[model samples]
Target: MVNDSLPPNQRRFFLTIILGGLSTALAVVAGWPLFRFLSPDTGGADVEIVEIPRASVDVGGAHFLTYRGRPVVVLQKSAGEFAAFSAVCTHLGCIVKWVSDPGEFLCPCHAGRFSTDGAVLGGPPPKPLEPIPVVLAGDLLRIG
Candidate 1:
């Protein structure tokens, strides 16, 4: 129970303060979930489209970039054909390195190898590297 020794006005003041504090706290508690749901999630991928110049990726070579916060590699297979793949290794989540000399992606962690099309070629990776969507629009290679 609240102390009764204080003057009436003082007690009312204290009660008002407590009531205001509780109201504010309740507002915060009730609004927290709604605020979180309406807020933009900065930690997740939010990019809608990524564009790369066609000339940036040469024929038989690779261009590396971050696609929606994941490592991605783009390769020009031919004059008008292009391919894109996630550079992350399927076995251990290591970023794969493109070796132009060997024409393969090498995961240094486990020696996992992947072909230009992201197919697992050798070593410990259980699956192919994830393929990313690519479209050629005029001079731009639209990637997602």
Candidate 2:
């Protein structure tokens, strides 16, 4: 409780200090998540490789996965060949989908299309899908 004996000016000063401190604390609490999200990945471990079983991806099919919190796609182009690319659309931040019949990646947000090889096919996408490295180890696929 505020001291009843305190002068009006002093009481106002004390209240101002308390309110300022509280508002500062509240701002920090609310802003921390936004700050972290906007900040780049500093001092974070780089995702070098990700292992996935061959059986999980069918022939001529695409498999979606996450790498370091980013979306990624692994496409089995043929019986023994597999390719990987970023699932993020180049035009915008929308995720791309695998269109099996046409054998391409489609961004539902803007109708952007990308070839199975990650090349741009149609719509507003400015560039091809970003390629990721993929290697076959025994019956597993290693992606980076």
Candidate 3:
């Protein structure tokens, strides 16, 4: 029963409100997935410990694995020392590679480098790689 008899200003105000609301709703629907994809997982309650065989990773070598849908790296620094870090680079979320000769991780995307112990060495990374909890369990490496 709406009609053109309504005042022009009232009609324009209602049209603006309706269009603005529709645009906002559409934006939220489209942007929610992108926000979730770019955001880091901050909840730790669902994370579980993962075990790897000590013999599998060689000295000065790295093993890439997935923990709770995220990439992780297990580094064998020496004969008996082991460390675990999130494989995602701090700069731009690119996966890092283990470079044994120089004993560091290299991010192919932006040339960010990290030490074997997960410290930022050179390049664009603003912070060190995230260290994961690691424990030795009778020839097995326990990581979380």
**Per-residue alpha-carbon lDDT of model 2 for 1-144, expressed as tens digits?**
568778999989999999999999999998999899898874323766789998889999999998866889999999988999999999978999999997989999999999988999999999999999999999899988
Which runs in model 2 stand beyond 4 Å of their true positions?
A: 1-45
Q: Which pairs, if any, clash in model 3? A: none
> What lDDT does the true structure give each of the candidates?
0.90, 0.90, 0.91
TM-score of 3: 0.68
Q: Please provide, for model 1 over 62-125, each residue's C-alpha lDDT reduced to its tens digit, 9 standing for 90 to 100.
A: 8999878788999887788898999899999999988987788999999999998899999999
State residue 49's C-alpha deviation in candidate 3, in Å: 0.6
TM-score of each: 0.71, 0.70, 0.68
Worst 10 residues of 3 by lDDT: 41-50
- Residue 115 in candidate 3 has what lDDT? 89
The TM-score measured for candidate 1 stands at 0.71
lDDT of 1: 0.90
Give a tens-digit lDDT track for model 3, residues 20-134. Answer: 9999999999899989999987555476988889988898899998887789999889888989999999999999999888889999999999988888989999999999988
